[model samples]
Target: MELISSAERNRLFESFKQDAFHLELRDDYSVPDEESPFTSWTRGESVDYSFMESWTQLIRSATSEGKTVRRVRVITEPHTPYIQWEHETTGINDEAGEDIRWLPRHRLPEGITFPMQGNDWWLYDDKLLAVGHFDDEGRVLGSEVITAPDVVAECVRVRDLLWGLAIPHGEYQP
Candidate 1:
């Protein structure tokens, strides 16, 4: 249960050699930086994406080094505004070399199970799991890094199962 800062997580992204897989289960994220953009998007105003430069660059660098960067977002249909915003802005991630996929929560396969963490996580090279922690308001607190074999195996299993059922960003309408 070692909590890590964003900079430390970025270091993991920069160092992973094989693959980086993110599982996003939350329907809304109350990130302070996204408040303005989300408001603008809801108002039908053009939203600025400059804030994503650093992340996009990191993904690009990872993919350029022959590592795969991918994510599977489990969203509810008739999405929350935040999820819609994320879906709309996914192109930035795609252009930056990430493979994004969507899975409607209801479409989840029967009998599927999640790890005990039951939170969003970034699994690096199928070995390290950086589990995201959020406050009740959906604000990110920090990530906990776990390397235990059983936990890591569970996360890997969840990632693969959901990833296989998710629709590619380009193909998913919502």
Candidate 2:
């Protein structure tokens, strides 16, 4: 199980030919880069969004090329503070041309199971996956790249199913 840093995983965007889809299963993400801004947001202070520039820029470039970037967040009802912060900031992602949706955990299809041990994953062109791993503190460790056809197929199936049930960010209220 080789792990690649998030930066390296992001590089997959440079070569993916069509769509990149992300399945987010966590209610809280203790991302170091987001700590300061998230803290400010939690404190009811203005958050400078400059920290997101690199990522948004990447999304913009990809979408401008006619490539699609999408995400489905599987969340819990009565959102966590981190999720609320994410919801508030998601418009920036939308503005950059990514399509993000929200699906409450309770809404998941009955008997449905997540592959890759329920880790969050980014699937590129429905062929490769970057499965996220986390530390005990819930901080991102890195992502493991997986290309087994069987695994990718399972993730693709899950993506299609969940995407259909998720509400677009613009339409979702908490």
Candidate 3:
């Protein structure tokens, strides 16, 4: 399990031939960069989105190239503070050309299972898998790159199933 750096991940995104899909199963993410912004949002203070400009640009460039970028987040209802913050700000990703969807955890279809220990992942072109590793507190540790056929196959199954059941961000109130 080789851990891929952020730069490598960006390169993969730039080089993907068709589509990039992400599956987020966690309800709370403890990204350090989001701490201050999350705190401000909790306080009802105006939050700055300038920090996301680069990422948004990346997505915009990808979509403009006719490559698709999509993600589905599985969240618990009555949302956690982090989930609430994510829900409130998903427009940033949408405006950048990414398709985002929300699925309530309880609504997942019965007997369906996820691959890669149920961790979050970015599947590029249905070939490469970048599985996210998080610390006990939910902070990012690093992403592990996997290229095994069986594993990628299972992830594809998970993506297809959950994506079909997820609601578009605009219609999801959570």
Model number with the top TM-score: 2
For candidate 3, write residues 1-174 as lDDT tens digits: 668766677778888989999999998988777889899999999998787888899999999999999999999998999899899899999999999999998899887678888899999988999999988888887899988999999899889989999999999986
Give the TM-scores of the predictions, in the order they appear. 0.96, 0.99, 0.96
Q: How well is each residue in 1-174 modelled by candidate 2, as lDDT tens digits?
A: 789999999999999999999999999998989999999999999999999999999999999999999999999999999999999999999999999999999999999999988999999998999999999999999999999999999999999999999999999997
Badly placed stretches (over 4 Å) of model 1 are none
Summarize candidate 1's per-residue lDDT along 11-65 as a digit string, tens digits: 9987798999999998999988889988999999998888899899999899998
Better model by lDDT: candidate 2 vs candidate 3: 2
In candidate 3, clashing pairs total 0
lDDT of each: 0.90, 0.96, 0.90
Clashing pairs in 2: none
TM-score of 1: 0.96
Runs of candidate 2 with Cα error greater than 4 angstroms are none
